[model samples]
Target: MAEDIEPLPVPRRIDFDFPDDIDPNWKADDPEFCAMVNGASLTMPYLEPFLIKTVRETARHIDDPRVQEEAKAFNTQEQFHYRAHRRFNELIKAKGYPELAGLEARMEAAYARLSTRSLRTRMAYTAGFEAMTMGVTRWLINNRVQLFGGSDTRVASFILWHFVEEAEHKCVAFDVYQAAYGGSLGGYFARARGVFHGALDVMFNSMRGYKIILRKAGLWGQLRSRLRLARRLGSFAWTVAPYLLRAALPGHTPRREREPQWVHDWIAQYPHAPEGYIPLLDTHSPTMPVPFPSARAATGAAA
Candidate 1:
């Protein structure tokens, strides 16, 4: 664990009351992108609990109070994130995508098998997955305007809030893994292995979700949709490949990762947000400035 680093993730119970009217295609103009994001969201209800349990189990073997405390905070934030996603997912299912029910069940079963791995493997997986997430959080925030610009308030805010918290605790899983293994050579290989194992597993499941949902939408048969989907997939791979490569290095530590200014602004301004909710990003603004309000119904007007 890095003793020199100050501050850890702050768990907020954001009341993401996604309205029944919230659009399935929240991005409106970009249904392909919407499906991609939806696919990722579908994984959360299943993915998060597994991560929470993994960290909880590993904490039993770790003596570092700071690592254990951060793990607890990470679990708390993950709890909020998955529960919120479950709500949004129900809305998704209701919006003529009941086929997604099968997708979620499959994801649940997949994570169950993953949970049966050794403790070191699970923690390594946790660390590796989080390493990928740190880079992804940066990509999503940096391109917030391009990706989420002019999107539904409920959907956009929910996705944005989820990633922001991801960035907040970027170091927790890695720190917990390091504390347990004491940075051995074998541990280095395990951690590196985890980068691929964890990231690939999640990506495989998410891509499945995308395939199923798009097929249901009848877009899967169209050539144009296929090409655009290919392009989107390529773009994401290109953006995050560097992060994965960096994380695979023997000396890689999340403490040294450089985060963009927006993430910094979000962390500093987040505490002032109203109780029980994270506020919506001002999607309309050019820079998407912060000091956000809550995500509840009364605060329905964009933040």
Candidate 2:
């Protein structure tokens, strides 16, 4: 008989408050930068639903009470993230980026196909996706200034808050999958396929978004700008490579270095602190000013 697995500890919910003082001229002044932000913002809706679904589905297989608790917390945090990003996406659309709408439609179709897989497969894929997110989070933390340019405190703060939670919950999905599947070969294969597919999805979508933003800003006039951005991103991808490699290796050791004291201190004083706070949005309908699905209801359905 299979031994019963123990549950992991539940994490706390996180809250995000949009900064009220962002420069209105920021987007128009730098179209290329705006495009990058918009592209990232556009990804929230599609990715959030997947996260919500994965947590909900995996909760059933989590026999351990601690793990189940953590899954619940994870669901809440992901919901907060989804809603916040949706708000950011609204700002992007307001800036005349109509391409984002089409992108959302494409992602919806893609996720609909993915939703048909078995629970085990979905769990494996979620683990893989989380691993990749961990890699990206670390890279962003290390290169925040370059990624956002200097002096844009709001955007920098927003991304940092997101990545910190992403880093904290990095292992939840993988641990949950292993517990449910007994570490079988099929489970590993499913995870690997998920990682590959998720990476490709992000890359293609990001490229299209970047191109659109650049063309709109008339920044496409300089061939060097395009090459420069691509090369920079390529370098950043290399930085994330080691994390992905380690994640793929058997019996990999998880990295849990604490955030620098200065960085932590900086984030601690915000209206929406990032470490352990989970923010509740004022509304849930698609017509809301900041449209998003209900985190509580979505996760509750899984439980």
Candidate 3:
């Protein structure tokens, strides 16, 4: 049935209005959790461009048309994601984290180092990162209410929108990897290596960013906050452990994985948010949020 569905990688130009008065932890009430998620967001502007370049280059060597098309679509979607996050990062910087720029520069340099590696190595890293994001996407969707409830609407919508797209183009990199390198034992080893490498990159970068944000906010050395952060990390690992293990299997692919119902329902009702904004999720209930088309949609309807 998935084969019967058409590939549509729509480029959305939505923006968020993060008020200057908002706190650093714009999403959840937990300061530690907020810092952790912010840390991850900080990596996108650098990490995503690296992904786009890697996928685009590898797509060139592949003879398959479908894979090529998917690669372009994947790059387009990531383009939207990174740009949106870049703007949000600016908002975070406005909140007085002057040290944030230094952290981002370090991450940029790290990716620059990675760019020198072989094509196969880069593609392996892309596949591995996508695989991990797929797991994180599912986890976030399943626990949407618990994690985002009562959070700032703009920030919540921004994060959910990005992850939803991540889920949408879930299989592109894996397909590219398989097309270029067969599912041989060597391929499996490359994918596994990527998983570890990408995971460490995210964790290390996120932890560093978190410490910077908390230190600037004057919460870094607070024992209570530190303990809460440790517990949250442990719980997150437990939730996504199954996905990490499954991704390591030779035959495992996102094609066999089921898409989350919330993501399904969300996309179905997409373009629903007003112009210049991301679609809002109902933080209080799992029920589908009401769909209201943007001014662009209304203009089309009038036409």
Measured against the true structure, the TM-scores of the candidates, in listed sequence, are: 0.93, 0.76, 0.89
lDDT of 2: 0.61
Q: How well is each residue in 1-303 modelled by candidate 3, as lDDT tens digits?
A: 136344555556666566777677876468887888899999999999999999999988999888888889989989988998888888888888879999999999999999999888888888888888877887777777777777776777778888888888888888888788754788788888887677668778988999999888788898988888888788788766677778777777777777587677667665455456456655564532422355335545876
TM-score ranking of the models? 1, 3, 2
Q: Model 2, range 1-303, lDDT digits (tens) per residue?
A: 113332332333344444445542343335455566567667777877797788788888677776677687778778777787887676666666676678788878978887887887777667767777766776765555455544344554566667767766666776667678737777666676766666666667766766776776667678877776666678767966766676666654244423334234333333334445433222222211111234334445876
Give the C-alpha miss distance for residue 101 in model 1, angstroms.
Answer: 1.3
**lDDT of candidate model 1 versus the reference:** 0.83
Q: Is candidate 2 or candidate 3 better by TM-score?
A: 3
Clashing residue pairs in candidate 1, if any?
Answer: none
Scored against the true structure, residue 98 in model 1 reaches a CA lDDT of: 93
Residue range with the least summed lDDT across 10 consecutive positions in model 2 = 283-292
Error of 2 at 43 (Å): 1.1
lDDT of 1 at 256: 84
* Model 3 spans > 4 angstroms off: 1-8, 271-277, 282-303
